[model samples]
Target: MVCLRERMKMGKRSEWVAFCFLCFSLSLQTIQGYKESETARTLKLEQGDAHEVHCSRERSKAAWKIIEEYLMPFVEEERYQISRRCRLHSDNDLYRDQEQHKIHVGVNEWQCGYCRKRFYGENYLDQHFDNRHYDLLNVSHSRCLADICGALHCDLVMDSVPRKTKCNPAAAAKNQHLCESLADTCFPVNGGPSAGRLHEFFLRQFCDAHTCTGGRKPFSRGHRKTRSIFYLFASILTLMLLALFYIFIYMHRRGMKGGTVELKRISKSVQKKKPS
Candidate 1:
């Protein structure tokens, strides 16, 4: 009976141990799942760089807004080397022999190629500096320069090899001519009235003030006056035609007496052709 009692206690202890282990494992799995889920959500938000990026989770909204409003502004004042790396299943997932391990998520680690300073998060490395170090920026320099290209400079080439030395002089001259002609002919009150006036007006309005000056009286105004005069002559001709049209309508309304009077001012054959 004592042996039986000892066996019962051992069995109960074993069952209790098993239950505790199971609960511990389940809790660990839940925590790990949460971590992976959060990471994926963060990645999804980061991928939306084509549009304004925002965190997917509502809990992260406050943090993201704070970063944008506060952190982003401050970052501009400081020198930084920010880079984006894709967090993949593995660093060398392609080379992984184990199929089960191959399909795992991997956190991308960033390091300054120059300084070899490592960072876990992209934001942390963004404000990387070289106060104590010398020439620790060869790797980050390429990315830093890339971000500044076109956005910060009037002339920026994405390609490693530039396509042209400079703009073709003949092509530039042609564009200049077309631009000037459009400015002269299409602008209201200054030149030949063109159908493209509205488009030109909007273009001038929206064009960058630095690149395209507005409200400045063009040097070609004098030359454009010639075309304006032609427009004026055309307007006069139209007015004359309209005046004759009104007169003809009035004369018809005034009946045969007006027609007879008009015929007397004309030849016999033309007079006969007049309306009775």
Candidate 2:
């Protein structure tokens, strides 16, 4: 009977030991799993940060190249490197626009804006840019310098994305002055009344972009909207002017066509003799 009781005690102690071992094993596994999850989260965050940095570098790389190679050589001011208003028209001497212009499409035909070459609909125009102007840009990093291309510069090529329009006037004054001066000096006043109007338009465009009017940035919505409004206004003004011109012509011709009554005048001596 004593041996039987001893066996029962041994069995109970063994069972208790097994239960404690199982609990310890489970707790260790839980700790390891939690640590692994935390490490995985840390790694993911590091990767995301690295990816963002890489993307930013890639985005600005092409813009830096443009600044150094194309713009900086003749620029008088170091600060104007990133400016949209300055040095835009001056860059034309270097064929800058032709190097980076967009493709134009017409009915059943595609034309390369850069080269002025025509292509059939069987091929894509995007492919043409890749082949011709690929060195001018990085297709993967698109929003390189949308806000900084001034005077219709990169209007079609880089204007695909809208730049943040909230310009700071105080910070932007120097560049604005550059643009205004370029307009006043470059465009000829003696050319005609049309030339005067063109100068005024450029002056307004360059300076007005620097101001925030009524707490709202001027949404040019790209050059397309600006050009459309200009054309519409000009068309309406032309029609009105033509109507007025025709009305004046019609009035002059009608007066000329009107019949006139004529009576013969008699001399004083003849009148005296005849009447008497």
**Which has the greatest lDDT?**
2
TM-scores, all candidates, are: 0.24, 0.30
What do the candidate models score in CA lDDT, each in turn? 0.40, 0.51
Candidate 2 backbone clash number:
0
The sequence of per-residue lDDT tens digits that candidate 1 reaches over residues 94-207 is: 111211211112255556544467767543443343222222222321222222112111132123464545435564344345444433333333333332443254234222
Give the TM-score comparing model 2 with the true structure, all chains together. Answer: 0.30
> Which residue segments of model 2 deviate by more than 4 Å?
54-157, 160-171, 174-276
Superposed Cα RMSD, model 2: 17.8
User: Lowest-scoring 10 consecutive residues by lDDT in candidate 1?
Assistant: 86-95
In model 1, residue pairs whose N, Cα or C atoms come closer than 3 Å (at least 3 residues apart or on different chains), thus clashing, are none
lDDT of 2 by residue, 80-116 (tens): 2222333334342222343345344555777777677
Q: After TM-score superposition, what is the CA distance of residue 151 in candidate 2 from its true location, in Å?
A: 13
